[model samples]
Target: MTPELLLLSADRVGVLVFALSGGIAAVRNDMDLFGVIVLAFLPAVGGGTLRDLILDAPVFWLEDTVSLWLALLGGLLAFFFTRFLEDFKPLRWADAVGLALFAVTGAAKAWGMGHGFIIIAIMGVMTASAGGLIRDVVANRDPLLLKEDIYATAALAGAAVYAGLVYAGLDERIAFGLGMLAAFILRALAIVFKLSLPRARP
Candidate 1:
């Protein structure tokens, strides 16, 4: 597939997964249908919205309404089937997958826009973590950004790897896949082992 098509696919996957994560969060918080939908929509597009705003680009969901529909669908499905997912914790893994995909796609978008490495990395991290941060805050929980785990760090590492590989003349698709894999593995290991960064000494 073309680079644009590949990125688009990644974006959709990230949106859907994050939307489900958000929906789960809303259900856990005892939110109503409207609240669930709102929460789902937030994480589904929040990061990309922030990135586009920062980049002075058109908002992605506005450009193509598929994202909005997907978010609503995910929310509604989760709302109606919360009982089915009670034993399955979907949030952590879904968030990790979304973060990995979004981070790589965000970096690719920044590179395509001719941004510098620093800006690309920043955008990638923002795209990966911003939505979850917003979701957590709205759910009255600690944002993952403030957590001790290697959340944003994983995104940054993946984005850096992708940017470096592309700069070094690797195929964009290959770079993106490798970057996503790296981020997913790191985040998954952190989750499996309950790992976190060292706390600052008071």
Candidate 2:
């Protein structure tokens, strides 16, 4: 597939993964079907919407309806099949995948739009974390970004790495792969080892 098509494919996968994570959270909280759908939809598109607004670009979901439909389908499937995922802890896994994918895709989009390195990095982190932030807030849980875990940090590192690689004349596809790998590995390690940054004592 063409580069643009590859990126779009990755973006869709991220949306579906994030939507499943959000749906799982809603179901765990005993949310109704509509509530589950709403939560699923929010995280699926929240980060991209915010990033687009910040960049003065069109909201992505408005530009393509597939994202919306996938999110809804994810929620509906999760709601009906929560029992099958009881032991899987789908939320954590899905979040990790979504975070990695979105971080790379967000950086790629910003770079394609001619943004500078710093802006691209910021957009990448925003795209990776904003949806989870909204999800946690709406679910009345502590936002992951505020936690000590290496969540947003992973995204920041990945984005910066991706941007630097691209600037250093690496192939875009290679850069994208490395960026996603970096984010996913960091997140996976954090999850596996219960890793966290040092906290303030105030």
Report the C-alpha lDDT of model 1 over 134-199, residue by residue, as the tens digit: 999999987867757888888998999999999999998899889998898999998899788887
Residue 88 of model 2 has an lDDT of 70
lDDT string, candidate 2, 1-202, tens digits: 9967776776777788788878888998899999999989878989988999988888888869999999998899779887775567655766787788898878888999999999999999999988878998998877767877889888987898899999999999999989988998998999999888888889
lDDT of each: 0.86, 0.86
Q: What's each prediction's TM-score?
A: 0.89, 0.88
> Which residue pairs show collisions in model 2?
none
Task: Look at candidate 2 and tell me the lDDT of residue 156.
Answer: 84
The reply for model 1, stretches above 4 Å from the true place, is: 1-10, 89-94
Question: What shift in Å separates residue 43 of candidate 2 from its native position after superposition?
Answer: 1.3
Q: Any runs in candidate 2 off by more than 4 Å, and if so which?
A: 1-9, 89-91
